[model samples]
Target: MPPRSGSRAKSTGTDFRAVEPAPLILLKGSEDYVATRALDRVKAELKSRHPELEYTRLDVSAATPGELSTLASPSLFGEPRLILAEDLAQMNDTFLGEALQFLEEPADADVTLIFRHSGGNRGKKLLDALGAKAVVVDCAPVKSDNDKLDFLRQEFRAAARTIHPDAARALVAAAGSTLSDLGSAAQQLMRDITGDITAEEVDKYFGGRVEASAFKVADAAFEGRTEAATRLYRHAVATGVSPVAITAALARKGRQIAALVDHRGPQNQLASALGLPPWQLRQAAETARRWSPRAAADAVEAVAQADAEVKGLSRAPEYAVEKAIGRVSASING
Candidate 1:
C-alpha cells in the first residue's frame, strides 16, 4: 500500500496504516488495474475501522492539479474524506505547481491524499518532500510469469479453490498476464470447476500444461550441487524466462542482502522496506549472516556482468545465468 497523509477523521473505526509519515502510494510498476485493486483493498480495511469515511474519485486526465490539491478539504457533513488521484501524472504543469504546494502543508482537513505515480519520477521533488512529512513507497512491477502465478494463488485462495502450481502457471500463460485476461479466466474456471480448481480442470479448460522449458535452467542454477548451471542456462534460453531475468534476480537478491548488512536497520522494518513478504525474511537473514559484505558485492558485480552480457552484449542467456549463479552460490555458501 502507498503512503497516505491525513488526520484521524474521527471515524467509528479504521486502520489507515498507523505509520508516522503517511504517503499514499500506488505500488510502482504494478499494472494500473492491479494497483487500483490494491488501493481498493486499503480502502476496505480503512472502512472497517471508520465506517463514516467519505470518498471522492477523480480521473487523472480530467481532474486538474488544483482540484487534486483541494481534494482533502472538509465538507459540510464533517466526515473524513479520501481522494483518489487516478493516473495523477497525466495532469499538466498548470496543476502540478498547485499540487506540490498543497503537499507542502496539506491542511488539517480531516482528509487523506492518495497520489499514484507511474514509475517515472516526474515532478518527484514534492514527493520527496512528502516522504519526510508522509510515507513514500515505490510500487515496482511484478514479473509476468512469477507475478501471475502469485496472483493466481492469491485469487484461488480468496475463492476457496486450491490450484496446483502447474495448474496456476498454465492459467497465467494461456490467459496472458493482463488483469482482464487473467481475471476473466479465473472467473470462468471457478464457474466451470464449481469448487477445487485442480490440474485436471486446468488441462480441461485452459488446455494441457506443458513443461515450462525454463524450469530446468532455474532448477539447475539453484541446486548448487552441480556444474549444471551453465547447462541449464542453455535450457532457460530455449524457453522464455529471459536470460536477463535470471541474472537480474541473482544480482537483486545479492544487493538486497548487502543493503541489509550495510544499514543494519531494524529487521522487521528492513524487511518491509525491502518489500520481502514476512515468510522470506528469515531465510534472507540467514543468507545475509553467512555472506561477507565483500562477497555479496562481488556476487552483485558478477550478476551485473551477466545481465549486461545476456541483455546487452548478445551472450546466450543460459551461459550468462549459469555462470552468474554458479559464482553467486559459491560466494554465498563459501
Candidate 2:
C-alpha cells in the first residue's frame, strides 16, 4: 500500500496502474471489480514489457498436481510467461500442495504467477505463504458512500477529466451503490459530456433514475423547503420510486443530523469518530445548527412511522411518506 506517483492518489489505497509485475502477485479480497482491475493492470504492464508474452490462465480448483510447475517451467519458444491462477480460495488439494511447494522454489524471473483469492479461510496455509512472498493487492469491498465517491473521483481523474463534487454526488445517488454501475455511468458521462462534468449534466443524463429522487426529497425536507420536498416526493412516487426508499433516505439524513446536533468535538475528530467523510459531516453540521434536540427526536419518530407505514403498516404508503416529509420540514423550520 505504497502511495502512487500522483498527488491525488491515496497513500493507503492500492493504485493498480502503479502495480509492477512480480514473481508472485496476490489479488486478495471479495471485491471482484478491484481484483479484475488490478489483474488487468498487471497484465498490461507485462504485455508492454514483453509484447510476445505467453499468457496462461489456470483455474486452481481444477488444476492438477505439478501443473503449476509444468506451466512455469521454461517453454520451447523461450517467451516470457504470465500465469494467472484464479480461485485460490477454492483450490483443490493437488493445486494447494503443489502451490506450497512452488512457493518454496518460485518460478524463474521470466515467469510470473498471479493468484486470485476471493476471501474465506479455504487455503490459509497457502494464503499465508503467498502473503509472505507475493506482492499483495487488496480488493476489499467498497461499502460506504464516502468510498464510492472516492472511486468516482478516481475514475474521473484517471480519464484526465474533472467532475464537480455535486456532480459526483449526483452520479453516486443516481447510479445506486453498485461499483460497476457507477463505473459504467461515469464512463458514459466521460465519453459523452465535454469538459468538467456538472450536476446539471448528471441530472440531464440520469434525471429519470429514481434512486436520487428519494435523497433529493430528504435534502429538501431537512432544509425546511416544505413545498420543494412535497413536490419532489410526489414526483418520485410518480416516477416509480419506492416509498421505502424515500423513508430510508429520510432516516439516514435524520441520523446524520442527530449525530451532529449535540456533538462537541473538533470537526475532523467527529468525522472520524462517526465514520463519516469530512464533507458529509460538514453538510450534516450545517443542517444540525437549525435543529434543536427535540426537533431531531421528532424527526426520528416521523421517519420511523413512515418506515413502518411503507413496510405494510399503512394502506396508503404515499400519504405516509408525504406526512413524514411534512413532519421533517416542520421540525427543520421550528
CA-lDDT, candidates in order: 0.58, 0.80
Per-residue C-alpha lDDT of model 1 across residues 1-334, encoded as one tens digit per residue: 2323452222211122222223343334436655565567667766776689888776756656468656666577877777766555575675567666665553554666666666566657755554454433334555555566666777777777787654565466445446656767887888777656643355456542223333333334433434665655555445544554455445445656787667665778876666555555665666577667888787778877876786558546556667777886677566
Candidate 2 global lDDT: 0.80
Q: Which stretches of candidate 2 lie over 4 Å from their true place?
A: 1-13, 215-334
In the predicted model 2, the residue pairs found to clash are none
Model 2, range 1-334, lDDT digits (tens) per residue?
3321111212233565467787888888888888888888888988999999999999888987678889999888889999999988778999999887787762477888889888899989988777766778877788665677788888888888999765676676677457777787898999997878866567678755754387789889998999999999988778656666677678767887888888887989977665566887788789899999899999999999988887678999889999999999999787
Number of clashes recorded per candidate: 20, 0
Q: State the weakest 10-residue window (summed lDDT) of model 1.
A: 11-20
The TM-scores, one per candidate, come to 0.49, 0.64
Residue 243: error of model 1 in Å? 14
Candidate 1, residue 252: how far the Cα is off, in Å: 33
Residue 58, candidate 1: Cα error in Å is 3.7
Q: List the lowest-lDDT window of 10 residues for candidate 2.
A: 3-12
